[model samples]
Target: MQIGITMFATDYAIPPQELAVEAEQRGYESLWFPEHSHIPTSRRSPWPGGPDLPKWYYDTYDPFLALSAAAVVTKTIRLGTGVCLVVQRDPIYCAKEVATLDRLSDGRFLFGIGGGWNAEEMEDHGTVFATRFKLMRERIEAMKEIWARSKPKYAGDLVKFDEMMQWPKPVQKPHPPIIVGGGFPHGARRAIAYSDGWMPIGGRGGDTLAMLPPFRQLLKEAGRPESEVPITIFGVGMDGDALKRARDAGVSRVVFGVPPEARDKVLPLLDKGAALMRDA
Candidate 1:
């Protein structure tokens, strides 16, 4: 099993590049940053965690820019978006960003994506909350066509474009791994149908272990080889028993959350986590 780290990349946090270098030196497998294009202050949607949503959600840096900074500083550790809200952005622009980042990072980019929960936030982007999942699916499908075709064109209910030229294809063959992020059957089915992996958020009202077998079964039912889809656990804290259970249940990666703090404080914990994984 591979151990990785995820951070909010807040303005007050240790700079992303510094964290990336330290994580690489400590033998971490990857560095992931989460995204929120902009948080709405309406507070209409209840916080998934609690009544008080964390302040870091509103102060976080753009995932692409943060991960790009991390890319230039580290050679081996993969850079990723812990969860990019595909429901809020244009797929064509997103395709360009993903491909460019993969090129800049020498193919070490994982595109973890999701249909986000903030309804008011999606409304601001002109996407209906109820139709966001269908839109996200179409957007991702369009992006895949753009990445793989020389003059790609896609026409769907949610996405339509004429044959257009886009250059600098992703460094990773068939594009970077599109890891769908969410919990349970809906997200698992989406990942099995189209994405390269499934990233079930830990600590939510979801059983990462119990969900795995059903996810594998979904892949088989979808006419996809189960071995092709990797299972990643996100926001995993440093719990030995949980980690062991996750691995025993066939998790490929566990990304521990790193609190926004000074590098001196965070790096040691990262190193300790990496060492524990190595020794395991």
Candidate 2:
């Protein structure tokens, strides 16, 4: 299985280009950047990770701009958003950004998307918390249509657009891989329905690898091949046994979580990670 890295790029953390260059030189397969456009201070919506959210969540650099910088510095490493909040953005403009990034990166782009967790944050973007998942799905579908057609039009319950022309169609055929991120079954179903892949947080609530068999069963039920909807488990621990188990369970990629820290602190971990892989 391929190993990738995900980091929340911030002012105090290692810069995107430096990380990307180092990651590529170390033989890592890809680099993922997470984003939180703006965090509301209301504290009404609970943080998903724990009782207190990390400061970096509110300090994240824009994923598109960071990844674009990464793309310029590295050639082989694939660039991805760990989970872009599609429910909180305009699909038409987002589609153009995706295509431009893909073209500039020589077709190496992975579009990881999520419905978002913060209720207040979604509300700030003018999206209702109750219908965010539906809106996310509609946005994904609409973006796909935009990428694939010269003059595309889509009409969904949450998202609608008239036929319009857009330039710089993605270098990848049709579009980049859309990896939907969430918990099992539901995310798997959404992925099978429209997206190119599924990404579940590693060891969240339970071992997501255990859910793969049932997920595959769902794929069979939908008449889709197992290979099409690959799993990309995020926040993975650096353990050989766990990696082996994930591979056996048919996971295509495991994205290791990197702490957002200064260069001196972060570089050693990156070097050690590369060394560990070499030793393995």
| Model 1 global lDDT (CA atoms, 0 to 1) | 0.90
Supply candidate 1's per-residue lDDT for 158. Answer: 85
Please give the distance, in angstroms, between residue 156's alpha carbon in candidate 2 and its true position after superposition. 1.2
For 1-280, candidate 2 gives per-residue lDDT tens digits of: 7889899999989999899998999898999998798889988998877899999999999999999999988889999999899988999999999999999899999999999899999998999999998999888888888888888999998898788999888999889999989887788889889988989999885879888888999999999997888889997767777777777777899888889998898788788667656654
Count: clashes, candidate 1: 0
For candidate 2, report its TM-score. 0.97
Candidate 1 lDDT, 1-280, residue by residue in tens: 8889999898788999999998888888999999887789898988777788898988899999999999988899999998999889899999999999999999999999999988988999999999999999999999999999999999999899999989889999899999999888888888888899999889786667887777787887888885678988999888887888888888899999989888777887887787678666
Name every residue pair that clashes in candidate 2. Answer: none
What is the lDDT of every predicted structure here? 0.90, 0.89
TM agreement with the true structure for every prediction: 0.97, 0.97
